[model samples]
Target: MIPDPTVRLIGWAVTRTAEAIVDRAADRIATKMKTCIVMTVRHRAVAALPKRGRV
Candidate 1:
């Protein structure tokens, strides 16, 4: 399903914030582990794209 612009934007912010937290936590645990966390953020940002394209 596709989210509206507002919804998608909100989701984008939420997802980004969550990813940042996760990435920071990972860095705290192990500095070298940040690459995986960053990759995960990239994956999620891509996944959040509306399947039907933008409104």
Candidate 2:
């Protein structure tokens, strides 16, 4: 069977495009997770701190 270079190139491009989309989604998810974690930690810390004494 004769291999067609154009078909192979097209397949590679499609695969790379799919991979880029997946990578972007993963990055967004990771960023959201990190933001949530940071917010939760800050809330907990603030809640745990003692009230400031009057001057």
Return the top candidate by TM-score: 2
Q: What is candidate 1's lDDT per residue for 1-55, written digit by digit as tens? A: 5669988899999999999999998777785567778989999999999788578
lDDT of 1 at 45: 97
CA shift at 22, candidate 1, in angstroms?
0.2
Error of 2 at 21 (Å): 0.2
Query: lDDT tens string, model 2, 1-55?
Result: 5479988998999999999999999999999999999999999999999999899
Error of 1 at 47 (Å): 51
- Cα lDDT, all candidates: 0.88, 0.97
Model 2 TM-score relative to the real fold: 0.86
lDDT of 2 at 1: 58
How many pairs in model 1 have backbone atoms within 3 A of each other, for residues 3 or more apart or on separate chains, i.e. clashes? 0
C-alpha TM-score for every candidate: 0.49, 0.86
Candidate 2 lowest-lDDT run of ten: 1-10
RMSD of each: 23.9, 2.6
